[model samples]
Target: MKAIVIGGGVIGSSIAYRMSEAGADVTLVEARRIGGGTSSTSYAWVNACEKLTSRAYFELNWAGVKSHRRLAEEFEGSNWLHRPGVVQWQGAGAEAAGFDEGDFDKLERLKEWGYPAEKIDTQTLAELEPDVDLSTFNPEGAIYYPEDGWLDGPVYAGAMVAAARQRFGLKVVYGQVTELLTRNGAAVGVKLANGETIEADTVINSSGRWANEAVGNADHELPLAPTVGLIAYTVSGDTSLRHGLRTPLVNCRPDGAGRILLRANDIDKTLPFDTEAVPSNPAAQELLDRVTQLMPALKGVHVEAVRTAIRPIPADGYSAIGPHPALSNYYVTVTHSGVTMAAFIGEGVTDEIVHGKSVSEFAEFRLSRFF
Candidate 1:
């Protein structure tokens, strides 16, 4: 069977690798180079905090996180793995009603996933993190997730691409899928930018932000939305900032590097991808100033890198990862957390396409959920 995947980011590469791993003829199309989109600009945080608000999202992401852990070990030779604990910071009353410590049900939901969190006292927090000064922190406490952290985003995508093409014998096409070719309301193939048409029995819409466009959805039936995320690296290279000290994965307060990797709550949401946007957000600037108060080491750090990429956000607060409603042969798998959930998302999609297994955790995440 021939399967064509759109997008060469982590999600596309992952699905390509898994499909080829299951003995399918897989071809991936990318408008740009591999890992060159949001995946490239990703300031990844792979903590199990994606579903902190809802119990179900928490469970799904927790499962995805565990899958990532196993894949990290399985793909250890790629050197895309890192074990840095995620530090969730909250100010004043935010902690009480925040992503870190919002609800007791959320904690209970997390407990089922084998993630036991604890509130850290100020003195204990200071002892554990001597570099941070919580003088400005007015939170009741902070939650620590020992299993959460970040990784080399591009390296992971490269590793998946290598495994798919070299090991699994998948075809990696360095082009864009301009349109989805259909026959009798069923997807048959895709037309590339070079006008080359390749027949495909299954066309997976794994494109992160451009899936709908790839499938010719001018009406926008899907609930997908994009938000710009900015990444700023520090030139000082403070070793104190190496522990993956982050706030909430969806959206939290400023981080230790004096550079806030804004979460979903702080999302600069807008439709249609825009890269020419400037780096001037009052909230982000405030984040930088506040982070220095917490970590004095960032007082003199130079900004190393600053880039913006559109993050896909589903309306239901979950990813759309399955076959199309009317066209099952044409599937879609996308999310803002693709960096964190790529491994699992790939595994699940491959299971359905190659092994005929259903992803129970995300049954509602399919496009059929809306229709």
Candidate 2:
């Protein structure tokens, strides 16, 4: 079963790793090194706290943390990966009330694989992050998911790509897959921008922003629309946020530092990706100000850098994985959360391709349901 996986982002590399593991002859194709897409720019969070009511998304992300742990153990010597428990804060307004009723119970299992999290009280919250000006918020503390961790996105993507090539018998092709080769209304293989075509029985469109394009190349529509998400990090002085924090208040930034990444939760409305301007939304500065009130550290850090990126979020805004509707043999696995969830069930993608199995609840993500 020779497989050609296009795009070398986390989702692409992960799918390739999974295919090779299942004994499928895999070939990973990329225009650049792995993790070059939005995967490289993500503020990697391994938590399911954001989805209070969305059980499906919660479950998928919860599963992703376990997947990363397996990789860490499998490659024990690699420090490129590890679980860094996530601490998210909600301040002022509803977030100040702190945690939805079912939050802890829903997220408790997230720590089972050595990643443990707990809900801290206001006093504990104060101690953990003294720099946060919890004055506006009642400082009700936040939920912590210990089983969660962050990884160098590109490095992890590269590592998985390496394993697929060196450890597993997989071939990786480098070029832009400008077109999908089809015959009798079915996907056969991909034609790169360089005019190279490799025939195959299966093709997985793991391309991130270009997902819809890949499907269109096969003369089909997958109902996916491309949208952009941006992340900009600023270098700073000794600021305070140690645990990663999220707010339900006016703030959209998740505050922490390895260089505090800002404006993670809002869309850069002024700079639509299709336009290509990809501007640093001036609104981000305001969003940063709002988040700093919860974590007072912004009281003193210098603005270091702000980077912008675009990702293809699903129309339903959930990660997608399933066979192409018209062309059954072709498949797609795409999402904005690919950085977190891809590693978790990354193997499941390969399983579906190699053995025709289903792991995630697809009633919501199924490709045909949209058509």
Candidate 3:
């Protein structure tokens, strides 16, 4: 079947790769450069230890983490994959929204849920990350996940698309999909911004934050809440970190080279909800200061850039995948943790599309839940 995959971010790149591998005539369409959108600015931490709300949701993210390991092995030469694990700690009060200590009793609950979480004291925390100021960062100890890690979304996406093109004859078109071509209430193709049309038997709307607009073009509506998040990149530093740190003030991870990528839920609260603009100078400085406080190694590291991008979060904050209820031959998959779930979701969704099988693990996260 001739399939057109929308968006060229991490999720779309994974889907395109998996679909092409399954012998489908795949075409990936992107409005701009691949992975230049929210994927580029993502924190990209692949973990599920702190998602204590729902067991099902936790399982989904956990599966994504494992899938990433498999991808790292498959693409052993790719420098974007880093599996150094993650360390997270909360403040004295209920400051963090999702990672709040009060929620589900925090570390105790994580251990009970069969998730690998180790409580570390200040000395142990210092041993894990010698450069970080553990006394000021995690005074009351912290939870560390040895299985967690991170990836470079843009680099991974670019690699996937390049492999798909060379191995499976995948066609990549660069232009905005202005409208969905339909016939007798079924999607047949897409009309591009340059007035070009490409016919396809099926179209998958994996357009991240733009998935809602893509749905609108197809004469349907998806209830998506695209929230904004600010990510700041710092200049390369001499001191290195062994794990991604999530303190109450800032969350930071190593950016392959010696640079660090920083963000915080507290800082994001001060910014607008759905803006495409970059963060202000003051906000950028504030993020740098917060990270430097946690990791004294980055005290003088310059803030290279700050980007504010709308995260692809469904209205209910769960995933919305599978075929559209109203539009035939069209499917969509979007969620908040796109980086963590990309490979797993892509592999599962591709099987459903090409082999006529349903991924049992993703049953709860289907688009039917919203409809």
Candidate 4:
């Protein structure tokens, strides 16, 4: 079947890779460069621990973590994927923001569910993260997930696209898909902004923050409440932070060779959604201060860049997959935790598209609910 996959972020890249693996004639399209959207600004933390809502969602992400490990092993030479573990701590500031209870409760629940979790004291925490200044934000204890890790999203996505094209003869079309061509109430192909038209048997909309607009191209509504997040990158400094750290004030992980990525939940709200522009000067300075407070090793480091990106979240704050009732041959795959869930979703979506076999795990995330 001729399949058109929209969006070139990690999720869309994965879908294209899996589709090609399943022997489908796939054409991956991206408006901008691949992984330039939410995937680029993502924290890229590979974890199921953050899924505090649905057990199925948690399971899906947990599976994604495993899939990533296998993928890393398959591409053993790639240095972008790392499973250095992740540390999460709650502090007085988090409690003041009313985030302590839910965060702590999620940790406890994960342990009960047989997930490997460790509650470490100051001494143990120091051993795990030697460069961190415990004196700055000392806590009673912190939860550690030894299975968690992180990846460079854009790098991974670009690699996947390359693999799909090289191994499976997949074609990648670059340009904006301005409209979804339809016939007899079914999606048949896409019309690009440059006036080129390509026919396809199926169209998969994996268009991150622009998913709602992609859906609207077919004149159908896909409810998406896209939110913006600010991610600041600093030139890598001398640091012994070997693991991903998610603190009350900052969530950070290593990026590239000598760089660190920083973000905060509250900081995301200060920026506007869908703005490709860099964060304002004040926002950038505030982020740098927050990062310094969380990791003193980064004190002298300069803010290389701050990206304001719109997160791809469905209206109900859940993954929306499967074909919509109003349109035929058009499938959607969108979620808040796309980084954590991309691998599993990609493989699952491939199965559905190729063999017409729907995976049971995706039952809760289908698009039928929106109808």
lDDT of 3 by residue, 13-51 (tens): 999999999999999999998989788988888877745
lDDT of 2 by residue, 163-185 (tens): 87888877888888877788886
Question: How large is the C-alpha RMSD of every model relative to the true structure?
Answer: 3.6, 4.0, 2.1, 2.3
Model 4 residue 101 CA deviation (Å) reads: 2.9
Error of 2 at 37 (Å): 0.6
Worst 10 residues of 3 by lDDT: 93-102
Return whichever of 2 and 4 wins on TM-score: 4
- Ranked by TM-score, top first: 3, 4, 1, 2
The count of residue-pair clashes in candidate 2 stands at 13
> How displaced is residue 316 in candidate 2, in Å?
2.0
Please give the distance, in angstroms, between residue 275's alpha carbon in candidate 1 and its true position after superposition: 7.4
Better of 1 and 4 by lDDT: 4
- Give the best candidate by lDDT: 3
After superposition, the stretches of candidate 4 with alpha carbons farther than 4 Å from their true spots are 95-104, 216-219, 274-280
Model 4, 300-329: lDDT tens digits are 888888877777888988888788778899
Superposed model 2: Cα runs more than 4 Å off? 92-117, 216-219, 248-258, 264-271, 274-281, 295-300, 360-364
Ranking by lDDT: 3, 4, 1, 2
